[model samples]
Target: MEQLHQQSILFAVGINHKTAPVEIREQIFVHEDEIPALLTELRKTLVEAVVLSTCNRTEIYGVTTRTDLDLDFYKDLLINFKGAETFVSREHFFASVSCAACQQLFQVATSLDSKIVGDTQILGQLRDAYAVAKRHEATGKILNQLHQRAFKIGKQARTETRLHKGAVSISLAAVELAAEIFGSLTGKTVLVIGAGETARMTAECLIQRRVGKILITNRTRSNADELLESLKKSNNFAGETIALNELKNHLNEADIIISSTSSPAPVLEKTDFDRQTNKILLIDIAVPRDIAPEVAECKNVLLKNIDDLHSIVDRNSRRRMADLPLVKRIIMKEMSNFLVWYYSLPLLPTVLQCGAKPDKEIQSEIVRVKEFLLANVSHVHKLAMQNGAENFAGHVEVVNTLVAMKNAALTLRLEIEA
Candidate 1:
């Protein structure tokens, strides 16, 4: 138990918009299908792990006992996994250990660290990421506790603070940009290129603006129809579903085109809009970009990609900055609670080893045990920092011991309370 005190390190490693450009982020993005295999590989080194790969960032959160597995090791794993060794370097990555790592995750879950600080989408993203990890058996007691706590903290932050008072998601930012371009959305016709969450959100925003009409086109007509039907239930706006191939025919009629498809390649080429003479605003919010870059060169076409929405995001973030302190306090309080529980884990085995005794003797022993465990835990932390990767072969054994102790302590306490 003493040996395991500081050896089970919780860590977060990866790159975000602040550390890496969108191009690098897209290259590192782990698709849903790739997560299981990636987690399998990570299990060789990590005791517990979760991979969160969104459009704006990709991060790996894990509990590892091996001191040898530093920040560089995780960065190299990502680089090798993505086959991005040629371009991606260690500089694009960032890592935090133990308490710092825990704080980072809390901030992310509460949307404090998002590209748009008050964005409401990150909480659901974190929830989905944790669900995937849990479903795959990639998480253990530590991660299970951490993520569940995060969800509670996230909800608390949103409910108690004004962090989400006027939340502006990426999709909303896109719609705002469209409004800015056209001066008004009252008579504007929007052509939505997909029926996913982003596309739906954008449509909803546009509907609120009283946009004249919304034309939805998708690779799958059923998905497009589903979105159209949902929107119809909410609003009486003229919503129409068009075939994917009919996109070109409607190009001239659409004043603002918002494309957020998951297609691997560009769905709209310059040639598709070459015959268009009417001015059109095209916003491509997809990671791979639904519209070809060359379309920007076409006549009467104004193209904007995801990066173009930064101006609007930045402005919205500033307005939300005043609520940050409130969210920060919530995060700090939650983080402190988590760290207290985490540090107490190693003491579980020692406390259980005390065996049964008279109430008076047990009370006195508890005081002495607390002092002893604190000193030993502090010493272990110092040694971990000083030794780094040296003598780390016993990492697995340390994790196993700590986990067993934690589970046993929990069961015993539950039985006692009952």
Candidate 2:
């Protein structure tokens, strides 16, 4: 029954790398455990919705019929959802609606809005969030169409462009930062904390840099072991995997530390730097941050977050800019196609019924005219009536074709509004 009632408003709200730094973004990071409650809370507002929260962005796409609920109302709710007091004022928020929001979502889905351009990982993250929303039954026809089209567009961008062929990642940028700090990683002992995607990618890049010793520490010992095992087959590096409980003991021993752990709070504080004697580069690539901000004050420790990696990723951004026109063309084309299809939907059944109510009235008129001609006219007038009837049928056929074409175009325009 709800599906039968069309929604008048399509809205999206959130913050992302473009709007917030890693520090502020982390404050709003929704944990998996809290998602269900969030969905329930949103459902009570009578807004059909889907939430996509990733390390880079937190966006809610919803459809509502209530014209009274402005975007600011939902923005306040979103801010509250993540605890507004935690995020700094005058920073860390962005929102868009209708066409702009749809465009932004398409850009996000294609990874064009990612911290790293053409990031393949974000596609998976988007899918994960979509799946979670689907399991929660928060999506309806509008979101379903939008997300599926976004996925298709994302795939098209990847397949059709050279956007994903180079070192465009936070991890690789971290490695570059280490190389800038240390000059060379050839003889360095690199410690990669956490066996997640970021950590593993950083580890790979470090190995590629020909680091002497590699140490992997993860909350789970088995994950650390798995990382080491995978690294062993790649190249001969003297490395070992250890449990996270022993992370602090080994911190001072390493020249470089790249952390990508999923800890909700700061895991590596200033206490970890108590016995440090040498200069150590610490790259905090995790959201909510694995390393404490205070640790940067220590003479030997250098702290860098995902935001700090942006300037370094600017080179990739410049290269990606060249392909923007082509991507925009693709988007415009898809949008036009979707609009045309949408605008033609309501017209389809009416067109199939040969004008429905209007056609019935015309039919009645024809019947009346035929009866009038038969009862009131002579045989000589019957010939003229036949000619008139043929002319009328011809005119009607022409009008029908013209109306159908007009309706199809109108349908396309309607889709554009949607």
Writing each residue's lDDT as its tens digit, candidate 2 over 231-321 gives 7897788899877888888877799888888788888988778888988888888877889999998878878888887677887778777
Please give the CA lDDT of all the candidate structures.
0.80, 0.70
Q: Write out the backbone clash pairs for model 1.
A: none
What's each prediction's TM-score? 0.83, 0.78
Candidate 2 displacement at residue 416 in angstroms: 26
- Relative to the true structure, candidate 1 has a C-alpha RMSD (angstroms) of 6.7
lDDT of 1 at 361: 60
**Best-fitting candidate, scored by lDDT:** 1
For residue 190, model 1's alpha carbon misses the true position, in angstroms, by 0.9
